[model samples]
Target chain A: DVKVTQSSRYLVKRTGEKVFLECVQDMDHENMFWYRQDPGLGLRLIYFSYDVKMKEKGDIPEGYSVSREKKERFSLILESASTNQTSMYLCASSSGPIYEQYFGPGTRLTVT
Target chain B: DQQVKQNSPSLSVQEGRISILNCDYTNSMFDYFLWYKKYPAEGPTFLISISSIKDKNEDGRFTVFLNKSAKHLSLHIVPSQPGDSAVYFCAASRGARAGNMLTFGGGTRLMVKP
Candidate 1:
């Protein structure tokens, strides 16, 4: 079984604070993704990394950036946390060609 | 504009009955379709999937049917149990993309009542 682990299950931060959400996968997948889920909005991609040091902006990447220094770890960074950024964040990983992504338990972020 | 759409926001079905959740997509380029089930406080789990070449795919109690002509797909859960209750999301992807980035629909909440 593939395991994807997130650094934090829940987090609360003050406005304008810097926040980091980490994700690690044991399956050695090549693709890692960060997504924010909201009611009525579904899961919107924030950023994704295809390889180490390579990143691409997804549909809603504003105010959010990602890092993939290693194959097993991916981190999402919020430059300046705002109340609008408060939501459930999810991390997922998938191997080549399969397209079936395994997801970690999400982190519910609260920016006050 | 929502490329993927789930018209029904919620559905309630009796246990031991059949539950049908429908999804539609506007992009004809989408060749791969998937269904994911998500519980509160948990990330979405991959349930089942179907390719454009095949019309139907079945896994245990879950079955996905795709209509290429209409650019639509549906998930059918047979003998629905309480455990099957969750928010179901439909996603589509164009296979040409290297990462298979998905466009998801607004999920439909399914409630299985005993």
Candidate 2:
């Protein structure tokens, strides 16, 4: 079974503060993704990494960035935390395009 | 504009009954469709999937039916149990061109009453 683990389950940060959400997968999947879930908007992609040091912007990449320095780890950075950025952040990994992605438990971020 | 949409935001059904969740997509380029179930405080889990070439796929108590002409898909759960209650999301992908990227629907919350 693929296991994806996040650094935090819940986080609260003040406005303008820098925040980092980490995700690690044991399966060594080639693709990692970051998404934010909001009520009535479903899950919107923030950023995704296909390989180490390679990243692409998703539909909602504004105010968010990602890092994939290591094969098992992917980190999402919030440049300047804002109230609107507060949402349930999820990380997922998949071996390929057609394969099913495994997701972490998710981090509930609250920017005050 | 949202490419994928779940018209119904919520549905309630009695246990042991059938639950049908619907999803629609505007893009015809999508080659694969997926269903995910999410619980409170947890990430969504992959439930079932169907290829564009196929019309139906079944797994255990869950079945997915796709209508290519209408660009619509539906998930049917037989003998719906309370454990089946969750937020169900429908997603579509354009195969290799998208590189695992998927467009997801708003999701419908299903409540199975005991």
Candidate 3:
């Protein structure tokens, strides 16, 4: 079975603070993704990494950025956290294209 | 624009009954579809999937039916149980082998009453 773990299950930060959410997968997947889930809007992609040091902006990547220094780890960074950035952040990893993605439990961020 | 849509925001079903959750997509380019189940404060988990070539796929008590002509898909859960209560999301992908990126629906909250 594939295991995906996140650094934090819940976090609270003040405005303008720099926040980092970490995700790690054990299956050696090549793809990692970051998403934010909100009520009614569902899950929106923030950023994705196809390989080490490779990143691409998803639909809503303005306030977020990502890092993939290694294959097993992916990090999401908030340059300046705001109240609107408070949402459930999810991390997922897949071995290849169009494959099932294993997701972390999620990090519920609260920017006060 | 919302490419994938789940018109119903929520549904309730009694135990041992059938629960049908529907999804629709506006993009004709989509060739693959998937269903995911999510609990509160948890990430969505992959449930089942179907390709455009197949009209139906079944796993255990879950079955997904796809209508390519209408661009609609439905997930049916038989003998629904209380544990089945969760948010169900429908997602679509344009090219299955090219990339894993997917467009998701808003999701339908299903409550299975005991």
Task: Provide fnat values for all models in the order shown.
Answer: 0.60, 0.75, 0.63
Show the lowest summed lDDT stretch of 10 residues, model 3 chain B: B94-103
What's the lDDT for residue A19 in model 3? 97
- Which regions of candidate 2 fall more than 4 Å away from where they truly are? none
Q: Score the docking of each candidate (DockQ).
A: 0.75, 0.75, 0.67
lDDT string, candidate 1, A1-112, tens digits: 9999999999999999999999999998999999998888888889988888989998899999899999999999999999999999999999878877889999999999
* Candidate 1 CAPRI category: medium
Q: How does the DockQ of candidate 2 come out? A: 0.75
Q: To one decimal, what is the Cα RMSD in angstroms of model 3 from the true structure?
A: 1.1
Give one digit per residue, the lDDT tens place, for model 3 in B1-114: 899999999999999999999999999998889999998877889999999999999999999999999999999999899999999999988785333788889999999999
Error of 2 at A55 (Å): 0.5
Worst 10 residues of 1 chain A by lDDT: A94-103
| Backbone collision tally, model 2 | 0
What's candidate 3's DockQ score? 0.67
